[model samples]
Target: MRKKIQIVRHVVQLIFFILLVLVVVGTVCSFQIGGFQFTEPLGAIQVLMGGSIFFTPEKLYILLATSAILVTVTVLIGRAWCAWACPVMTFNEFIEYIMKRLRYKPVAERGKKKIELGEVRFATLAGVVAAAGISKTPAWCNVCPIGAICRTRSSGLLVAGAEMLILGVVFSANMYEKRFFCKYLCPVGGLLILLGKISSLIIPRASEKCTGCKACEYICPEGIPLFRNPDMSKCTKCLVCYSNCPYGAVKIDVI
Candidate 1:
């Protein structure tokens, strides 16, 4: 059985994000659709690239403030932003759930030989920054899924098509690699992962009670080896390990 706390927390997060989307994009919100200031971390990247081309000074200040808050929170709670907030993560989890229901032989299956894609996130982060600097515009903004989600439907076929293409690529890749986009591409998630390294939060293993069942290891979407400690930064704090441990051997602590 699934854990109630994580499920409830996730549902609440989804509801809050949907309401934000309703206000921002009317009926067109999604992973590549509607969003809010607190929903995505792209605005901060835009600010650091230069000033906001679209936001007024007041709004820019709010965006920066919220981004700081997000980073601070992540530093305190590990990468819980992905677990508890990100729309991309939320949708990916849904896609993963559906894939499971359909019994798709998920590529990230337990004991599978995993594709090792290290440093890609850092590279993409650098690429986005450089592209934005060279273009003197938020280069990725036009195609940012959160911005697209928050855009008006009148943007016509080009925007919609781009969003669909991006979504298709990411979702299709998910079939072969669970959360492939977040793991390998998303710059914002990369930033959060960087911040999470400084966070004291962690899912501690009660080695004494673990009994080597490996249930936690099997349930991890990130394929983290949770029998001991997971690959710290790779653990997104989903707490699936906590819930799946029949012996209740996984415990979270702020260290």
Candidate 2:
């Protein structure tokens, strides 16, 4: 029964990943065919910061309010977006799939050992701060491929640049490690880590059942060792650990 559940979850994750890629491709094609102008929606924060004002103040206010609500929810729900929603992450997984099929595993069983807070994370934050200080708009969001891809149908040049940049980085990372983007870059993942600390939902360990076989650790895509810290910041809460656990030791709960 447990194996069946794991298989189903894996299949669902793969399907969602494929759908996200299709959405990006279709949106870009539609824009090319329709000749629509790319208009970005403005948030209150963006307006206050003196960034590009694509939308009215009223709309920006609404956007800000919506962002606040979403951030609040994220603080309570772990990085659900990373696990089940983010198209970039989904595409990353698809890339992993390609590597796997070719028997060229991008991730290793031993897991990549590294500290949670490192120079890369600090540099990323510093860049965000500099951008925010200089411009009303957050530079991180401007460079986000997810937003770029979603708007590809309208903003051909911008989308092309974004895709080219992301693909270059992704390919380079794959040449080194499986998910270097999620590990060292990704401003969104950084924000999600901050939210994850207060998340209502978490992956917990069943100490009684765990035999310390480390199967879950070996299979974890994020390099999280469940035995060390079940609530590691990098965990996407995809439930892959729970599904792969030979002892069924990992579980999810509202904390």
Candidate 3:
């Protein structure tokens, strides 16, 4: 049963990765081949964050409605968006594949590792401190390659250089550690972690079946100990832990 679940999970992940790649390709091609201007809805989110009120009332209403929907989903399912929907997560998975193909192992092995929360906390704190000290928004978002990719795409640049640069960094980092971006950075991931604690659905451990073998921990990409706290904020509910556990100790349950 565990093997079957793992196979299914891998298949689903593969399909999702393919879909993400296609979306990016299709969007770029629409502009290049079809001569269609690609407008992303998330552009409004960025514009609003930038304090631009140029959008019509109708547009603002739409953006608010979309945000409400996203919040509802997050509230219901934790960071399901990070796990199953985000294009960036898809790209991160692809980078993992390439790293594996190159025989480059992540520095942090599953059971033997934990996400260095101290590092992440310090970095986030530093950002806040810098922002307050200098009265600036800090350089985090400016250097975010996702924003760069969107900007480049909006400007009609096919094969976005910024995206490539980010991919290069991810690949290089993966040669040393798995999910370097997810662990130490990624503001979207940070936000999800903060909100996931109150999520309706959470991953939990079946303590009765658990043997402390640490197989689930070894399989977890985010470096969480499934046995320690199944409701871990960083867990994406990817099911890798549940599928990989030989003892069938991990399961999804309502929190």
Better of 1 and 3 by lDDT: 1
Model 2: CA > 4 A from native = 1-48, 51-57, 107-119, 155-162
Model 2, span 42-96: residue lDDT tens? 2223344664544576755655554565466567776666767566666677777
TM-score, per-candidate, Cα-based: 0.79, 0.73, 0.71
Q: lDDT (CA) for every model shown? A: 0.68, 0.60, 0.59
Candidates in order: C-alpha RMSD to true structure: 4.5, 5.6, 5.6
Best-matching candidate per TM-score = 1
Global Cα lDDT for candidate 2: 0.60
Write candidate 3's Cα lDDT for 80-125 as tens digits.
Answer: 6666655566667777878779986676653466455544734663
What's model 1's lDDT at 139? 80
Q: Show pairs that collide, candidate 3.
A: none
Give the candidates in order of TM-score, highest first.
1, 2, 3
Worst 10 residues of 2 by lDDT: 28-37
